[model samples]
Target: MSNYSIKAISNASNDAIIQLKELNISFGITEKTSETLPNPAELFLGSFAACILKNVERFSGLMQFGYKKAELLVNAVRLENPPRMDELTYELTIYTQDEKLNSTLLKKNIEKFGTIYNTVKQTCKISGNIIVHKNV
Candidate 1:
């Protein structure tokens, strides 16, 4: 098994920074909120979306498919009583000439192979649909 780790440091305020290699991401700690930085919940949802997109690119190469571009939108529903994500929904749009032929297969591979996707699906209700737009 391979082990991965990230480093995070926080000051006295409600702000923290996470480091992964050369990347640095700032997040808010307290409920006070900040327009510049994401909160913990937002970061969680964003990580899910990022994982799906990364897999989309990986599967495209492995399956020998081509696409002009891809876009993803994600939303999460939080339960008030428990204060946790109850459900998550995502919409992925892929711009490619071969629309109907490969969309389903690509979507299947992403759900099957994505690490974060599978992990999140275990605890929260995850659902999404893919839209293939044939590039002109």
Candidate 2:
């Protein structure tokens, strides 16, 4: 993974391309990206969740913490009049007993450092909490 910090997660959104070095992922995105892909809202929700998960790996290294795994469940509310995602909530579970793991700091970093999270929060109401499981 790339080195990332609360201040170092400095990339702005709206680019057509994304690359994940560790995962060997490099793809260019476009409007109506792929017919095989899920609908826009579903894709957005996946992106939202992905951002959080990515940040967990990110902050874990930057913050010097360890975790076995992390899981996230994201739920959204749809508005039909204009067709939009109005609200988003997430349940994030991090399985770790690292003494250095700080939930409060982690949550704040994830929220502030996330690309999709920041973009979505600009227009939608977002609320979520991080659950740290010490013995898993």
Candidate 3:
């Protein structure tokens, strides 16, 4: 059996917060309109972004890419009626002092083995692009 548990709290104002007991994190949610709290769907996308970033950081070290900086942008589209995610797009920019390393390989390492990418890809359609810049 898994030793992880999820817990959360919310206010009358519709603000929601959750904690991952295993990871010891407390995250809050707020609505875009303020009429209600941020929906679970939003959190899902946010979690995916976090997961991918974490994996990239770990993989970068193992791959010895000499990264100077990294940034990611994530966007999602939600379906109507069912109010579910239809598509997700990610763009990652990596800065490194070495230009000889193929950016394509770096992108493949992140997208193929990233925990979040694997998890999301199993359930939904996912696609992304990566850009590497010579660090100044």
Highest-scoring model, TM-score: 1
User: Order of candidates by lDDT, top first?
Assistant: 1, 2, 3
The lDDT for every candidate, in the order shown, is: 0.88, 0.80, 0.72
For model 3, the run of ten residues with the poorest summed lDDT = 24-33
How many angstroms is residue 134 displaced in model 1 relative to the true structure, after the best TM-score fit?
Answer: 1.2
lDDT of 1 by residue, 19-113 (tens): 99999998988666667679888999989989999998898888888888889999999999878999999999988885434888888998999
lDDT of 1: 0.88
Candidate 3 structure, TM-score to reference: 0.77
Q: What is the C-alpha RMSD of each candidate to the true structure, in Å?
A: 1.7, 8.1, 3.4
Off by over 4 Å in 2: 1-37
User: Which stretches of candidate 3 lie above 4 Å from their native place?
Assistant: 1-3, 21-39
| Residue range 1-136, candidate 2, lDDT tens digits | 5654221121243223233444322222434445443444675788899899999999999999999999999999999999888999999999988889999999999989898899899999999999989996
TM-score of each: 0.91, 0.72, 0.77
Model 2 — which ten-residue stretch has the worst lDDT?
6-15
Which model, 1 or 3, shows the larger TM-score? 1
